[model samples]
Target: MLNLETLSMDQYSFVANAFSFGLAVMASTTIFLWLMRSSVAPAYRMAVTITGLVTAIAAYHYLQIMLSWEHAVSIETGEVVATGEPFNRAYRYVDWLLTVPLLLIELILVMKLSQQETINKSLKLGGAAALMIVLGYPGEVAETIGTRMIFWILSMIPFLYIVYQLVIGLKESVDKQPENVKGLMHIAAYLVVASWAFYPLVYLLPLAGVTGGSAIVAVETGYTIADIVAKAVFGLFIFTIAVRKSEAEAGASGTSASKKA
Candidate 1:
C-alpha cells in the first residue's frame, strides 16, 4: 500500500538535512561544553560530563541515521534503491537505550541527592527508562498495526511510571533545591514530558492508515526534532542548573569559612 516512489526528493532531502543539522549541533555542543570543564565546580563536573556524553552519543547516531537514510533512498528521485542494506532506524533506539538512563542519572546527580536516595531513585527510574525503550522497539519494527499497538501500550506503562516518579517521587528532592535553580529543574522535568510526548503521536500516525513515504518522512523528521529538544536543549538546562547549584554551594562555603575565621 505504501509506494516509495510517491516520496519526493524534497522529503528525502528534508530528513537528510535534519539529520545533518542534528549531528552538527549535538557534536558541536559536546565539544563546546566539554571544554568548559574549568568553569563549573568540581561538584558538578560529572553532570556536565554526562550532558556532553548524551549529545556525543546522539551525534554519533545521527551520523549513522543520516547515512542510513541516504542509502535507503536514492537522493535523486526518492525511491528505495537496492543498497543491499536496511535503513538503520535502530540507530535511534540504540541511542535512546544508552542515553535515556544517563539523562535520568544526570538529573539525579545534579540534584545532589543523598547516596542512598540517589542509588534508589536511579535504579527505579533508570530501570523504567531502559524497559520503556526495549518495549518500544518491538512495536517500532512491527509489521502489523495491531502488533505495534500492543507493544506501544506495554511501553506506555513504564512511560507513565516515569512521569509519576518525576512529578511525585522526586518532589521532595526538588523542593530541597536552591531557589535559583528550582524553576529550571521543573522546566527540565516538563521538557522531558513535552518532547517525549511527540514520539507516540508520530508513532500513532501509521495506525491511522498513514503509511508510506509520507509516514516515513513524518516519523523520521518528527523524531529528529524531538531528539534535538530532548537531548541537546535538555542538556543545556541541566548545565545551567548544575552551574547555579555549584555556585550557590561555593558561596555558602565561603561564607561559612569566613565565619570560622
Candidate 2:
C-alpha cells in the first residue's frame, strides 16, 4: 500500500460514488418500507415500521458520511487532495450502534414469539449488539497492531455470542414460526450472520497488509454494500415475513368463520 496523502482521481471517485450510492439505497428503502406498512397486519406492522426506522437512521448518517468524505478530499488539477479535514468515520459507528440492536429487535418481533420470549430475547440480544459495536470502535481507531487485536478479540466476544443466540438459542423459536415464513426466517438469520461478519473482515484490512488509498476505497465500498444488504434488503425480508404471517392468520380466521357458519 502506497502512502496516499493525495489520492488519484480514480481512488477518490470510487469512494465518493460509494457514499452516494449508499445514501440512495438507505433513503429509498426507508420510503418503500413505510409506504408498504399498511399491507401487513397491525401486530406485525411495528416490525415493518422499525425496519423503515433503521434505514431512516442509516440514510441520515449516510448523508453525513457523504459530506464527510467530500470535505476530506478536494479535486484540484484533476487530482484528489487531502484538505486537512479528516473524514469522520464515527458517523458509521454511530449509525451501527443505533440500528444494529433495532435490526435484531425487528427480527425478533416479526417472529411473533410469545410475549415473554420476545421480551427476554430482545433485551438480551439488543444489549449484545450494542456491546459488539462499542467494542469494535476502539480497534477501528487503534494505531497499534496489538491494541487493535485486543479490541478485536473483545468485540468478537459479543459478535459470536449474538450469532450463537441466533443460530442455536433462537432455532426453536424460528422453527415454530408459521410454515410460510419459517424458511424466510432461516434466511434472515443467515443474512444477518453473513453481512455482520463482513464488518470484521473489513476491520482487518489493515492487518491483512492492505493500507493507504486502496484500503480506504475497500473499506468504504465494502461497508456501503454490507449496509445495503443488512438493512435495506433485510427490511424487505421483514416486510415479507409480516405479509406472509398476516395472510396466514387471515386465512385461518376465515376458515374458522366458515366452520362456525
| C-alpha lDDT of all candidate models, in order | 0.85, 0.89
Give the true-structure RMSD of model 1: 2.8
- Model 2 alpha-carbon drift over 4 Å, by segment: 1-6, 255-261
| lDDT for each residue of candidate 1 in 30-94, tens digit (9 for 90 to 100) | 99779985567787899899999999999999999888777765644434444555677889899
Q: For residues 1-261, what per-residue lDDT tens digits would candidate 2 score against the true structure?
A: 223454679888888888889899999999999998887878998899999999999999999989988887778889777778888898999999999999999999999888998899999999999999999998888879888889999999999999999899999898888899999999999999999999988888788878777777778899999999999999899999998998888778986435434
Clashes of 1: 0
Candidate 2 residue-wise lDDT at 29? 92
Best TM-score among the predictions, by candidate number: 2
Best by lDDT: 2
Residue 174's lDDT within candidate 1 is 93
TM-score each candidate: 0.93, 0.95
Q: In the order shown, what is each candidate's alpha-carbon RMSD?
A: 2.8, 2.7
